[model samples]
Target: MAKTSKNKRTFKRKLINKYRLVILNEDTFEEKLTFKLTRLNVFIFGSLFSILLIVGTIFFIAFTPVKEYIPGYSSSKLNKKAADLVYKSDSLQQIVNVNTIYINQIKELLTGKIPEVIFDRDSILQTFHVDRDSVNLEPSNQDLEFRQQVEAVDRYSIFSEATKSADVVFFSPVKGTLTDGYDSQKRHYAVDIAVEVNTPVKSVADGTVIFAEWTAQTGHVIIVKHAGGYTSIYKHNTALHKQQGDLVKSGEVIASAGDTGELSTGPHLHFELWNEGYPVNPTNYIDFE
Candidate 1:
């Protein structure tokens, strides 16, 4: 016990031992600066300084832009820009895909390459499980009133006249027998007029051809934009006489009627008339008898 106590005293004395540090002028031998320090004080001061230095380095890296210079570190601005670029690239790719599809369809139309139709019997049968005999397909009173109001608004808006005076003359597209009538509930918003194959189909009014291309479901389709917010579509055509952007006079032959699409059962013209985006019965505008 005595020896241990003596050793502790020696260690404490060494830690507390005082030293004098002096800087003197070499020529004059005069002391310019002096410091009286103990071993313990020096060690404490050095440890404090090292701890402050480490803390300062951490603060500088965490709170300043210098952190961005470190390898594998990225700024918020650069990350955001990278994310935006990725989104824009994806959007551009989607647009390119859509345009490519349209271009391919146009090329097929120009080359007269109609795709062969493959009927999916299972898919068609899956959609027909409804009990057709029990369904009430007639429109309600409210539905009739809504349709009337819509028709009233369209007639006045297109002609700027009363309903009775809103009649506009339209040239018949073809002299044919009507095989099917317009049924919006069935999604068949056009009249199917059965005409002889290669029969000339005329434009119902003066218009510019907005789209003249072949589609997989509709074959050689032509859409015309006319004045008074009117539009016409002729589908299942074998050939189109007018290209997109061509202007045609009323009664001008625009396409030849034929069964060329997947939906066609025989040689016919699928004629649709639109007024401000709503489909209208073609029989109300043009006589197909």
Candidate 2:
């Protein structure tokens, strides 16, 4: 107990012990500056200075742009850019899905894979108990007014004009005997016209050529997109004169007839007419004989 108490007293004396620091002029031996300091005082001032330096460093990193350079830190601008990229990726995925579906539909149209179902309209009307005598043929005042309004709007607006199947004028693609007519029961959606090799095939209507490419099954094939949702396809061609995106007038030459495909039996033109994605008989529109 005595030794411990004596050690504490010595430590306290050393901490409180004062020392004189003096700066002197060498030649004159004159004291220019002096300071009376203790060990405890030096330690307290050094500790306070260290604490202030640490606090200042922390504030500089937290509030300034320097924090972005440090590891494990992200900037607000970087976060925004990352979010934008994520949204763009999602949008691109949706566009890709839509394109895939569209391509599949085009494949079905080209391969004649669309299913055809025939239903009896007379039987359906009888089952529904629809009587022609009970139905009124006259239009009400409101219906007449709406029809007049629609007619007035369609007269001035060319884009709003309704296209009737009868209004379309189809030009004959070639002068040849029809070898095979469109048979939905046999899944034959096109008409095969027998013609000589290298005979020029004309467009049925004014339109833009949408597809012109070679295929294994159809050989050189060309498709035209006409106004009023009309699409025309020509296959088993020797060559396509008008490329894709080319505009063609009615009866303009677009391709040459040939037996170039695996399915071709002889030199002929396989012509197809589609309205709003449904195949229609070419004989109904244009005469090939």
Candidate 3:
């Protein structure tokens, strides 16, 4: 017990013990500086200093840009920029794929390779609502009167005198509301028909395709040369069914409507009629109700 008490006393004494450090001038033997410190105070001060240093380092790394320099650490700005670049690259790749498809279609047209025509019979029947069971044996009064007027005035015929009666028959190109009518003064030669997306565009008359290609202003445009110097133009299509040099029957599916070109506002078809190289109103000849 006595030895233990003595050890405790020595430990306490060491903890509180103080030492005087004096610096003296060598030549004059005069004291220049002196410091009085205890062992306990020195230890406490050193521990506090170490703790402050650690806290400062942690705060600097957490709040300052210097943390980006450390391995495995990334800057938020750089990460965001990388993500944006990846998105842009994906969009560019999609655009390239679309252009490639258009180019291949144009190449097939140039090579005189006609694409196979596929029709959605159900959609067509539903749109037109044609009743296959019913048949009108007798002509209506309106039809009889229209026939008389057509025969008397001959206003419906636009072809040459030799082919006027033969070329008077025309099939409606599409079933839609006419948004814009042909106006000679405004130079709007084509009639705009607004319709649902992927609606099939049909030919106005039996003709041979003379031009089928993509254009910057009109997108996928197809031109057909009919008998009696008549030509029909269909533009702003999503996909073309017939290529150049392909013979198309009246009311045959030629293309699908879409908003493809730069000038397009929505899915629609642009139809234009030309007679002897002069632009003519298509609505005058075909009744697209």
Candidate 4:
């Protein structure tokens, strides 16, 4: 009975040893000991791996350069060049004064009474809203004398008779009553609809929104360029409703009224209409009365 008991104990011991794990020796070609890896060790290794991945990604973005797209950044550069081409550097007021004086002096001495540039005069008055008062000088100084010369040369600016017509309309240019007739006097070529500040303004014609910008003189201004070479200008806006490149229909609300320019006495709309590249009396075109 003692021998049998000892044999049974020996058998159990051998079975236990057979199932024990052995880590094979890498270099010594003998059995090697091993430690059981705990869960904490595995968690630390995973955390370090994740941190390294995130840091590498951040470095790639911060150190590398990239490009961006922005609008109107080049407007200043391009506009300067365009302005130079479109107009002379001299002041329009100075040139007008000098030319006016020169023309009057020459007209007095001429025998033919100086053939009046009637068609040219009509066209110039038609285009820029030039009035006789605009060219008329006070007759006191050298600057005043020069206006006559400017008016004389202005004869060459008549429309080429080939300009195509572009239609126009108005929501409201100003809030005041039509105080003065659109005559050849005040040189107020554009229509003035006088209104208190904060009056809502809208588009007069169906067109593409070409400009919605702020200026030092005009304040918040919007310009819509329509087909047929026609461009409508809305100046002295209190706020703008639409942005550039928006397609707008006639009578669409575009801005609110305000006094924006150096020429403005009160809140008003200095609304100008162009027909095939020329400024015509807006009164002749649209029925805003």
Candidate 5:
């Protein structure tokens, strides 16, 4: 018991004992600085300083933007910016997808490549709430009279002829000798109108230019999409006056003719007319003499 009590007192005295630390100049042994500290005070000061340093480090990392540079650390502002960018990219992708689909449809129209459809006759009739038995099969008196009037008109008359008897009138793109006419079996869907080089080619109808670009087979080609689903194409042009998306009136000069393509034998206008993705004979509506 005495030995234990003596050890405890020794420990306590050691903790409370004061120590003097001095800094001296070695030449003269002159004291420049001194510190009187107890072991307990030194230990307390060290522990408090360590705790303050740790807290300061944590505060700086947590509250300041410097933490973004540290590994395994992220900033809330960066997260928000990343999220915004992701949403913007998603929206832009959607817009691009929609535009691609629209352009594909236009290309299909230009190429006359119609997608096949499963025709459900019953479903179509039911959707329109029509009964086949109740529908009139005979033409009315006015319809017969109109048909007679249409048949009496000359087939080659540009003023009377329209697209399948529709009211739209087509103007001739160019008036010249027809070197070649539309032949579907040979896959020649356009009339090769032999015209002088640099002759002005006009639009067939009031429409908007949908395509105007150089092609390997057609050279400088321009396409116009008109109302009533009619589209006209002019190929082998020296220069185009209108660009894609330009609105044009009927008979407006859109391009100058040239023998520019690999298929061209001489300077002429290769003109094609299409209605609802099917090529139509341009002579049926226009007098390209």
Candidate 6:
């Protein structure tokens, strides 16, 4: 009975053991049924390894030299840079309007109508007045005023008052020291007789007073459009002796000379003779007699 009691107690103790019993397979030396790891452990390890792989791939992509990997970033950046340079260059000229004129022949230059260069630029700067380099365009020869004046010469005929007989005796326009000879510097296309104020101005020939008005450099000027396409101009006058559309005989008291407007250089007469429309040397006609 005591032995039976001892066996029963031993069986109960075995059932109460904390460690699990292992069954070893004789063929493989490994346990057939053993307490190893839980399914939860496997899930944790797999998740950690996956996170590490994703992090490594992201780092490689960011540092790689492949430009196409990122969307339109590189192309957009390049276009922006080019645009900035263009903007900067345009700002320097500060151009308002741009006129571009084109001329065919240089011989026809400045004689034809002033060619319109659509790119007429109006600048904000005062020092940037109308100059060759400052103007942002080219124009045809016919477009200029000077050229038109030159061409107009051939279109008209001057009225010759006499073949030999003279109705009125023509006289010199002014009594002054000749500083600039006739047609010198091309600026003084006429003879500049340096005289004092209100000097006795005379007409070179018998004609009429047509245009008596004030101009920029010519001051209170008188333009006598002659019988022929010939015209005579007396510039830099302080006063007018004749009115517009008035008739006067040769050697008549038409105008007195003074330094007015752009004629302020010591009170002189800027007298010009135009044949057809071109300025001819007055010395050619002025008998040095």
Off by over 4 Å in 6: 1-169, 287-289
Could you tell me every candidate's TM-score relative to the true structure? 0.44, 0.44, 0.45, 0.42, 0.44, 0.41
- Per-residue C-alpha lDDT of model 5 across residues 195-270, encoded as one tens digit per residue: 9999999999999999999998878999999998889999999899999999999999999999998978999999
Sort every candidate by lDDT, greatest first. Answer: 2, 5, 1, 3, 4, 6
lDDT of 3 by residue, 1-289 (tens): 9999999999999989999889999999899999998899899999999999999999999999999999999999999999999999987876666666666666776687956444333434354455766866789999999999878984443432222333547788999999999876666778999998889999999999999999988899999999878889998999899999999999899999988888887889999988776777777688889
RMSD of each: 25.9, 25.6, 24.8, 20.9, 23.8, 30.3
Judged by whole-model lDDT over C-alpha atoms, candidate 3 comes out at: 0.84
Q: All candidates' lDDT scores?
A: 0.85, 0.87, 0.84, 0.69, 0.87, 0.68
Query: Residue 27 CA error for candidate 6 (Å)?
Result: 99
lDDT of 6 at 251: 70
Clash-forming residue pairs, model 5: none
Q: In candidate 2, how many clashes are counted?
A: 0
Evaluate candidate 6 by giving its C-alpha RMSD to the native, one decimal: 30.3
Which pairs clash in the backbone of model 3?
none
Model 2 Cα lDDT, one tens digit per residue, 102-173? 566567766889653343334343454558998999999999999998887833222221235556689999
C-alpha displacement of 266 in model 4, angstroms? Answer: 0.4
lDDT of 6 by residue, 1-289 (tens): 9999999988766555456558898898788887644444556678999999999888876666554457854655677999999998786545432222122322245576546333222332433455777665766665687777888795325333224323333467766677666643444567778787888777777777889987887789898866556678888888898889888766777888888885467778888877666666666566422
